[model samples]
Target chain A: MSSTILLQSIGFGITTAAVVAIGAMGFTLQLGVTNLLNLSFGNVMTIGAFASLIAEHWHLGLAATIIAAPLAGALVTFVLARTLFALFARRQGGAFDLLMVTLATGLIIQYTIDALAHLQVFQFSFPSGSTLNIGPFVFTVLSLSLVGVAALVLAALLAVLHLTRIGKALRALSVDPKLARACGVPMRRMINLTWIISGALAGLAGLVYVTNSLTVDASAGLDFLVLVIAAAILGGAGSPVGAVVAALVVGIASEVVAAVGGSYYSQAAGLGILALVLVLRPASGVWSGPSRDEVTV
Target chain B: MPDQLLRVTGATAGYRGVPVVREVDIAVGASEIALVVGPNGAGKSTFVKAVIGELPLMSGRIEFNGKDVSGWGEERRAAGGIGYVPQTRDVFPTLSVIDNLEVGGFRLSPKECKQAIAQMFERFPALERLRHRKARQLSGGERKMLAIARALMADPKVLILDEPTAGLAPRIAHEVLEDLVVGLAKLGRGILLIEQRVTLASAVASHVTVLVDGRVSYAARGDEFRAVPDVSALFFGSGEAAERSSWSAARGPA
Candidate 1:
């Protein structure tokens, strides 16, 4: 029985890794390209989940609901970046200011959702299809598909980043905004593209999260953000592949602890790992992308 | 002489509207190389920043190719054919030499970009061997050459170089001035060069401007400037009397 429980925990851990990887990839990409530590990222994911929920209530098809989630996430994030975040940056705001801005924005989004949904958990009834047993592990067809979704999202993002001129410009902008501008790059346009791309992936992650847990709530995204942050931080800034690897490690460790102890211990494990990473790589602070001198220019 | 590619008149600019450099007037015409020289903290960089639109003009009119570009941003000025090589971090240090050139030629076709890269390699043969090397790995002189070659990738009609030889060996600095600046000027491109090594740059200057305390202290043609024996006096001096005793004591007024 103990051996069986360990195998089951491993299966659950793989599912958690898939979920963390999706959100962590989006989080790191946005953090790297834009250099904004958007603490409100969790709130954006909450928004994505609610958007698909609203679509479903309106009796939209599953495909349309799936598409709506990311669209809403992208739109809201783009608006937030262009308007609120932009205001702070223009006034010579530092890293700390941007972080506070994100925290406040996240709070505002979270409360707004709570007001709309009445702070109640809603059952997300996606068809589980059928269960499948592979060797010592068992998974629902839906659980297996979540891994596929994360992989596809990663593939699409990597393709866009490596294959396009806009992506090259985005990478260059991250290194030196002044030099990129001197090279005749459209600064505002590239920034907007990154916001849209990052936000879209965030939305998709939300849909995946709600489908896996079989429920959606205003606090859903905030709860999941801990794992995402741990993964993004542990992976190192600006590396998507690193995020995937970090997520797998964090996810498996957390799930294994949860199986042995409880949810509280599992969360502690993730946070402990995050603390260890920060202690070791102290230089990877909030301002990894640009220095104070470079950003002002 | 060809048409004036860039003209700055009554340019008053500074950080946050404090006016670090005041009422600076500079003009660069095609095939002409204008050298601006001054001591440290003389606002030579501020002058370049004003021309490039990095700092806003409180009150001035900037003309490029006969059109008023005072309202244009830095990126527009660059895209409109003004190549700028900043004093420091001119090349992206993390990127390879070839990658730096490719970024400069972002607006070009694949064929055109490749051709331009080949031309750069031919001009700076040292870079051809180090094309795949990161810019940070290059020596001081090689990095500067790569910076200039990258700027030339766009085929800009006018080039602005800010202290391009600030920290180079005298030999390498001489090669940069004589080979790169002179060669680019021969091809009919206007050049605005900021140099601290006043003695060396004057040899190739069509005209020279001396900036002191954020103002133009002296402006003269190269032939007239060569007549002054102690040009270093025009530089380094702080007050009016010191300024008068140096270039004026050495020779009569232009």
Candidate 2:
């Protein structure tokens, strides 16, 4: 590949990373605090995309569709967490068992969407007003807006985690829920807030993703799930800042590989990074102590 | 005498619907220290858990600040001014000392939380010096002190401690019990302490309750408890017979 082509691929990689970071942030927050490996997260993202699509089909403008997407995502995620996930957690299920439950939940959501949409791919498009060149990289207006959105989301998350009272409660609960409760931190309210915020981010990620990829289907989120998990694990599971950085590395590497090899090998490149990370830092991805068994939600 | 800050009357509680502690009565007045000491499997910790709302009460009433809190959840009880320091994982190890203190004041307003944290730093100078460091990075003594300080951040009416000095050296354990635990009671808050070091605990306790095989083997004021000839016997012997003798000895021709 030529130098210009390589630079262009790198630019595309950064944009892809931006979307991945949004999804990974939410996934890591929920995973870190609850210790629930929610395999259903991707399907929730699909739900968000479909929500946006339906809003648009009803002649709702772009702004309304965008707003509706995250709202739908938050509501569904909150309800499921309060109901289905809470039931399994109360049954004294371990983390691995909860993970399996989430996997089953994801399957159900995927098939439900599949049946709803009659197993057909739907096209999605957002206006790409103009293209801009920054140094050797080129980006469309829509792509830049996506990157801007990611930046805003990260900044907001950082503010919430650092500057707010609820953030302190969340950090404490994430580290030690029992201790947090003993200290008078309300676990239920904090957990409900987590679900809503994380779900909103997941929804936003879905919308941005479809805007870039220009297609939506029941399996779209399922297909993207691997990348989300990879970024989250590579970023040490719970740290949003770490997730963003990891997403950049994964996104750039995959894009570069695709430039050299083919699009089919791009995902494999991302998986290779995940595999290497797991081998090098076993403690990050795998539970090593009895401490992991405690449930917060 | 000051009002009873915490009163447990006939509190029978256990795990998995099986009784581990039976018909235990304990009380802590304002500015008093009530220590629960016993041998292994004596249900000292279980009784503390029961009082703190960690375990369900099979049948009994727990009153805090003159209100019956038997049906309240642990968090609700905490919010009602019960500060508990658990035996293990007492602090959020990954959080900084200041952050740990901040979490402790979760019920406080932002201004009050800041004030409480500042007070903690002044009280625990060691924690102040290591304020930015993680709780896990603190020494054993520092961690214990941090846990106690964190519990106090809520400015609770009653403080419940479960084996605060369990793994500490004899010297450190003595310091924790004497300097910290006793010192807190001196501040006029009721304290319920579960301790393994009978000698150290008995020396400072205003009152003592002894548990053996899931029941209170002996309960008495500090002076009466100190007069007992052998504590090890009370722990090792069949509880009821020894308890009667100890009770008579404690009464002494009344």
Candidate 3:
């Protein structure tokens, strides 16, 4: 393949990476803090996108939708987690059982959205703007904004995680909940905050996704979520930096593969890389992410 | 006992309602080190866990700092001036030493946390050098020191340690009990330790309790324990450690 096409695909991949990073960060944040992989994350993303679309229909400015997305995402996610998820967890469910419950919950949400939206796709764009040329690549205002926002958000998250006591408690909780409890880390309060924070990010991920495609529909989130889940797990389920890096690698490879070969293999390409990494380096500490055993859910 | 930091009476606790340690009694005061040593299935760790609120008492009462914290969770107990170090997985292995200390002092203000961390660093010169290193990278003795430092972060009124020297070399285990454990007691906090090394326990322990078949078979002051004729044989004669599984759930195969 020509270098120009490769670079262009890589540029496009950056946009995909940013979206996946946000979603993965949200997913992994909850997974790390609560030790439950909330499979309904994709449905929550769809909810955020729809909330934004509803705001747009009211003729609110784009910024209003931006604010609405995370608000909707956070509220919905927190409620579901605290109510439905907590009930199941208290029933002596193990990590695997909790995962299944999340998966089933996601499907219920998808069906609910299907009925609400009448199984239809709706137009929702970021208002087309002038494109910018950087080196051999091109990007619109929205695409650049997505990348910039991703970088800023990631930086802010990293700072909080490293520099603050709350961050220390969070990291500690994720590593060992029992020990964290012993250390006086308030599990209930911290857990609630985790759901809210991750929920907000998931909502932003929805905005990142729908804003890029300029379309809103029930299946939009579920379609993109496969990649996000892979990125979250492969990134070690708790590290935001790891999630973004994994997202970039997977996103770039998929886009480049689509550019060079059949587009049909793009998703397969991403999963193949994950499988390859898992096989070749099965041990922890080799990668920045924690070992799979450390986080069973 | 007048200045007691911890008191447990008729404490019965186990996994899933099945009794592992039953009807036990123990107490520790400020400047006292209570050593609990027993065979593999003696339920010593279970008793420690019961006191720390990881395992709720099936029956009986636990009083800490004159407050009955029977229904409290581990976090509440910690916040109430109790610190704990488990036999294993005591430190967050992935975190740097400084980070682990930060978590230990989770509720401390910035200034207080900084001061506590500094005190720990000064107290453990080796830890100061390894502050930036992850806990997993430390030697066995260093990890033990780090665990103790982490538990001490909150300046808790009481500290509980479970098998701090389980996998350590004999010399290092000796150093832990002789040097660090003794030094910690000098700080005037009530310290409860579960150790398998009798020689080590005999040196610093102010009190010793021997458990067998999930019961307190023997109890005495530290000097009395050391003065006994055969410490190992006192509990090992039960032969329960070989027949029963240990450290797992008390229930059978669930």
Candidate 4:
């Protein structure tokens, strides 16, 4: 590929990285705090997208649809966390069992969405106007806005995790819930808040993703789940900043490979990097010791 | 009785529905130290957990500062004036020393939190020197001290420690028990300590409750407990009639 083409691909990769980072941040936070490897996260993202679609169908404007999506996501995530996930966790479910539970939940959600949408691919359009060229890189207004959203989300999350009292309690709880409780950090409320925030972020990520792709289908989020999980695992499970950096690495590498090898191998490239990282740094994947119980977020 | 800071009566608690410590009663008054000592698998930790709300009592009442807190959750109990320092994973290992203290004072006002953190720094000079360091990077002694200091940040009426000196050096263990655990009691908080080392327990404890087979095999004042002849044999002996009789005989008129 030509140098100009490679640079353009890199720019496109950056935008992809932005979308992936949004989802990965939420995923890592949920995983880190709850110790639940939620395979259903992608399905929740799809649910958010469908919420936006329904809002649009009702003649709601762009901003209204955007707001509706995250609200739906948050509500659904909170309900599931407080009910199903909490029940299983209380029953002494191990990490692997919780993962299986999420997988089952994802299947249920995916099938439910598929049945509702009649398995039809819906065309999603957000006006991009004209592509803007910045030096050697090109980006649409939507793509740039998506990147802006990701930046805002990151900044907001940083402020919450570092500057706020709730954030300190969250960090402490994520590390050790028992100690956090003993120190008078109300765990149930904090966990509920985590579900809502992570769910909202997942919804926002879905909106951004579908905006970039210009298509929405029940399978849309399922396809994107691999990239989200890969980024989260690569970034050390719970760290949002780490997830963004890892997303950039995965996105750029995959886009570059797609430029040279083809789009089919792009997803494969991301997975390959994750596999390589896991092989090289096994300890990163093993955050909790064997004796430690799964902490419900 | 009204001044008793913590009291556990008929507390039969354990994992799941199986009781590990049966019908155990213990109490700590204001500025007093009550120690629970037992051999391996004797359920000393279980009894402490029952008091701290980590384990539900199968049949018991846990009262704190003259109020029945039997149904209270750990956070509620902590807010109501109980602090806990676990044997392991006690500190937020990833957090800096100062941040750990801040988390400990989560229920306090911002001003009180700041003041409490400052007090912890003064109390633990080593923590002050390494205020910016993460808890994971601290030595065993430093981590123990940090855990104790973090518990104190909440200004609790009672502090529960589960094997605070489990992995410490002998000298460091003595220093922690003397300067930190005993010191906190002197400051007027009731202390419920679970220790494996009887020697250390004897030194600072106002009272000691010995457990065998998940039952309180012996309960007496610290001085009376130390006066029991063949104390090691009493502790090491299986929970049988012969051991119980010999233990009672060794205690003389107790």
Candidate 5:
């Protein structure tokens, strides 16, 4: 491929990376703190996008929808964690069992959303009017805004995780919950806050994704969940900056591949990279997210 | 309150009703170190766990600092000044040394926690140099020291250590025991240690209990026990104590 083609692909990839990073950070944080793969997390993202769509339909501004989606996602995930997941936590569900529980929760959420959206498709209206060109690449105002917003969210999340006292407690709890508890970390509150943060990020990612793609459906977030998980695994789970960096690389590589080849192999290229990383570092590769030892009881 | 910092009376605790530890009564006081020693499967570890609220007491009353803390949850007991370090798996191996200490400082304020961690670093200068390194990379002795230092973060009134020197070189083991006594003496923290090394235990502990087959067979002061040999045999085998005591004494040379 020519350098021009590569450069354009890189620019496009960075934008996609921005979206993926937000989702991956949310995915990683949820898995790290709860020790649940939370397959249902994609559904939470879909809910957020739909919530934003509803807000937009009511003539709310883009900012309002942006705020609305993550809020809605956070609330739902919080309820699930406190009411349903907490029960399973007490039973000491190991890695495999926890995965099943999260998968079930995901099914419940996706179907419930599918029922609400009437099983029909949604073509949500996003702001469209201006297209900007930054020296060889072009993007709409909405796409630019989505990238900007995702970047802001990612920065905010990293700051919260690294700077605050709460963040220290979170990192500790995510490493070893029993030790964290013994040290007097508020287990219940930390668990709840984690759900809120992760769920909200998932929702925001969904909204941004739908805006960029210019379409909405129940499966919007699910279509990209694999990429999010790959980014998280490629980065270390619980490392937000690492996840973002990995997401950027994956997005660019996949886009460059798509630029050269057909779209059919785009998703496959991302998976191939993840497989390569896992093979190279078997222990880190197998360490997809947090295990039960990380979650608070 | 006058005689004890912690008291467990008629305690029977177990895993899933299997009764690993049964009908045990023990007391510990301030400025005192109680050492519980026994062979493997003798349930010394189980009794320590029962006192710390990790294992449910089948039937018992654990009074701590004039309050019945048996019914309290593990976190509550810890917050109220009880600290427990399990035999192994006490430290988060994946996290850094400073981070592990920060985890143990969860109950304290940010300033207080930082101060406690700094104090730990001062006490363990080796850990200070390796503060940024992960616990997984540390040697067994270093890991044990980190676990103890982390448990010390809250300035707990009572510290319970299970087999603090279980598998270490003779010199490292002696260093750990010496560190343990010196550290506790500095804080005046009531210490409860479960040890298999009799000489080490007898050297550091003011009070010692020998648990055999899930019961306390002998409880006496270190000097009192040093004055006799037959009483130590009643719990552990006569020949075993002689071997361990001489080994530790020869190795320790203190």
Candidate 6:
């Protein structure tokens, strides 16, 4: 491929990586500790984007959409964790059982958002301005800001997990939930914090996602969820830094493939990479029993 | 002093409708060590689990600090100052030695947790050198020390250790038990030690309760039991007559 082509792919890849990182971090944070493969996480993201769309239609501006979407994500996830996931966990849902619950929840959220959006296939009122050149690469200010926000969120999350006491508790909890509880870590509150944090980041990611493409429908987050899961499992479920790195790798690889192959094949390329990793690396395989005490949230 | 710090009156508890620990009555007092020794399937661990709320009580009551604690969950019991060190898996393997202790000191503020952690390191000394290491890398003896230290970070009034030395080498086992008993006693923590060896019970234990088939075969001071002839056979061997003779030997020695 041409150098310009590669640079452009790199730019697109970085932006896409930012988007994937946000979703995957949230996904992995929940997955790391709770051992839930929440397929519905994608649906939650779509709901959040819709919540922003509602805010936008109400003339609440871009700022309102940013706040509304993430809050919506957090609220939906909180309800699910409290009302649904908690019940299953009580009966020892294990990883597989929780995955089933998440899959069902995802379908419910997707259809519910689709119904609310009045079965419209596209909603493109989102603003996208002139594309700007950063060296040999090109992208809109919107995409740059989307990348910027994702980076900021990831950095903040890392700081929280490392520097803060609550973050320390969260890390310890994911490693061993029962022991975390025995230590008096206030497990219920921490789980709530995790859901809210993950949900909000996911919501922000969904909105940024719609902004870059300048169009969104019910399947917005769901289409992206496949890539998010691939990135999370690739990065190692419990580590946030690893997720960002993996997202970058997947994002760039797929964009480079799109540079050569047709656009329709780019996503499939990412999945192929994930499959290769899973097959070659048995130790990091997602099928192994998740460490439960770490992820009760 | 009161008769007991904890009392289990006619407690029955188990898993999935099958009772592992049958009707059992036991008592433990402050500044005392109660060692529960029995065979593999004799419900020793089950009784410990029931008391700490690890296993649900089928029927019966557990009283702690003169209050009915049977209805209380693990957190409530912990808040009320009951500490439990579960076998092996209790430590957070990925967490650093200090972080594991910090988890144990969960009720404390970050500053207080740090202080307690310092106290733990100061007391154990060995843990201080290994504070940054992940728990998973620790040797068997070190892990047990970490487990007990983690539980002690709660500054609990009553500490229960379940098979703390089960998988350790004999030297490591004796060393861990000695250090644990001495360190916890210095803090005045009430201890319930469960051991398989009769000699282990006689060595550092203050009180010994022989549990046979989920019932107390004999309960007395550790000193009293050590003087008796063939207490090991009474505990490990079979026969009603042998149990009676040993009980008599235990009493007549003094």
Please tell me which predicted candidate would have the highest DockQ against the true structure. 4
lDDT of 4 by residue, B48-78 (tens): 7888888888897988888899999888999
Tens digits of per-residue lDDT for model 6, A106-196: 8888888778778786674755567998877898877788778878888998899877778878988777677676666777888889888
- lDDT by residue (tens digit), candidate 1, A1-297: 398888998898888889889989999888776777788888888888888988998889998889988999999999999889889889888878888999999989988888988989988889988999988899999989998888887788777665665666666776777877888878878888888888988888898888888798998888888888899888866678778889999888898889999877877778988898888877763335345243321
Every candidate's lDDT: 0.83, 0.85, 0.84, 0.85, 0.79, 0.79
Question: What lDDT score is found at residue B108 in candidate 4?
Answer: 89
Q: Listing every candidate in turn, what is its Cα RMSD in Å to the true structure after a full C-alpha superposition?
A: 3.7, 2.9, 5.0, 3.0, 5.2, 3.4
CA lDDT of A286 in candidate 1?
Answer: 37
**Distance from true position, residue B195, model 3, in Å?**
0.5
List the candidates' TM-scores in order: 0.89, 0.93, 0.93, 0.93, 0.88, 0.91
- lDDT by residue for model 5 over A171-257, one digit each (tens)? 877777777777777878898899999989988888877777667778777767777888888887788878898899888888888
Chain B: TM-scores of all predictions: 0.91, 0.94, 0.91, 0.92, 0.88, 0.88
Cand. 4: chain B TM-score: 0.92
Q: A219 in model 3: Cα distance from truth in Å?
A: 0.9
lDDT accuracy of residue B73 in candidate 3: 83
lDDT of 2 by residue, B164-195 (tens): 99899899999998899888999999999888
What's the interface RMS deviation of candidate 6?
1.4
Best by lDDT: 2
Clashes of 6: 8
Off by over 4 Å in 5: A1-7, A128-144, A260-264, A277-280, A285-297, B94-96, B114-143, B228-254
Could you give me the TM-score of model 6 versus the true structure? 0.91
Docking quality class, candidate 5: medium
lDDT of 3 by residue, A4-123 (tens): 898899998888899989998888888887777777999899999988989989989878988999999999998998787888777877778888888898899899999988999999
| Fold similarity of candidate 1's chain A to the true chain A, as a TM-score | 0.93
Model 5, position A44, has a per-residue lDDT of 85
